[model samples]
Target: MIEPASYSATEVLRDGRTIEIRALRPQDQQALISALDRSSPQSIFRRFLGARHHFTEQEISYFVNVDFVHHVALVAVADENGKPVVIGGGRYIVIPRTAKAELAFAVVDQYQRQGIGAALMRHLVILAHNAGLEELVADVLASNTAMLKLFENTGLSMSTTRESEIVHVALGLSLPA
Candidate 1:
């Protein structure tokens, strides 16, 4: 069953809007799928490094299916026009035998700048820290300046390596005592 108490937050946006950030539930598969379906091709490419019309059964299963230990996933939702919708999502899978995790995030095209992605990242980072993770890494498209700027705003160790069209970002989360 989905445990909201373990990982959930309702925060106010900069513009007085409200959003709920919580652990993704199994029932959220279709909502997420639809969110992806509504994402622009460029946004999809920035998130996945390629274009995908939709998530396959296996892929969607992997998304909403999380152990909350090694694999943590969360979604940002808000009421739009009296109906709740998934605006953004973030997740991190711990690297085998390491204090690091691979992270990813995707926001709906319409909700790009309403702090959804930033909020998701904050929540995901807290989850990762609680789960004993030390770092988060992702390969972002070089052309995706918005995502890169978001990563920079996190104030983490923010190091990157560029290879062709992709930029690998490694943000160290474990701070020294």
Candidate 2:
């Protein structure tokens, strides 16, 4: 099991830019809020399924504080003009009585398509495996091709079902060989 401590790693993007990935912490509240606020309306809608342009204090607080056992959150930070900025984030909340969890990811508009979301997802997958989770699930909009492709590239055979406007993807955590 991963220790209940902040983990860090460096990932190289498709364009060869590097980013720092670390466990999300309470101190990241402002950075997290800033990234979400600066995201495009369409990006916000794609992530939250609505035009949630503003984040409440309670919501920000809840997202930053993770237990790392049943709840795990990671952030991808990039230095912009010498200051670290939150560009992307990924997290999963465990389902009760099962080795499964619901996963989510969001990357700022300017950072999209740079593999930030995929890197965050990669870290989340490792955290899930170390935590002994068996499956990771996500409910993404059918039109969110970027996110859909990121999930698909996990290399695990995913079972997908479409209902209404939501596409549910289930990936078994056999921990991609």
Candidate 3:
């Protein structure tokens, strides 16, 4: 029963750096496209864990135009000369017939390990909780140790399994008292 309009932008400070966490704005479509376009081949590979280096227009539209009622998209940004640059992003999609959500996140190459991804994930977790979700799940490649560590250190209960060369992780969020 969360109202998307009530969500507000907030800044998180980690390791002496400040990053903005907020819901995606309509004006950010071009910035997101540019960020996706500028992503390195390896970054794309790590995020999607495949040779698919490009995103179709339909894919971009779907990611940006999530149904606000049942899904939420949050982005981490750094402003350069008054224009916001997308450094990281995460989204939560409610699963039908379940109180769990599927979470996905990616940080730009230059911003990795600087707390951008964690900040984005933390914000998205709060959003999911506000929306009454009970858990968050992610599918990550086995080789992506950074993502694994992020989830592990988040203090959530998680289980992992190998699927071919990829790893699937499921995290159950602790309900807020």
- The most accurate candidate by TM-score is 2
Candidate models: Cα lDDT each: 0.86, 0.88, 0.77
Per-candidate TM-scores read 0.93, 0.95, 0.89
Highest lDDT: give the candidate number: 2
In model 1, what are the clashing residue pairs, if there are any?
none
Q: How would you order the candidates by TM-score, starting with the best? A: 2, 1, 3
lDDT of 2 by residue, 102-132 (tens): 9998899998999898888888888888888
| RMSD after CA superposition, every candidate | 2.3, 1.4, 2.1
Question: What tens-digit string does per-residue lDDT give for candidate 1 at 50-152?
Answer: 9877777788788888888888888889898999999889989888999999999999998888888888888887777776778899999999998899899
Worst 10 residues of 1 by lDDT: 1-10
**What pairs collide in candidate 2?**
none
Q: Whole-model lDDT, candidate 2?
A: 0.88
TM-score of 1: 0.93
Error of 3 at 167 (Å): 1.3
Predicted structure 3, TM vs. truth: 0.89
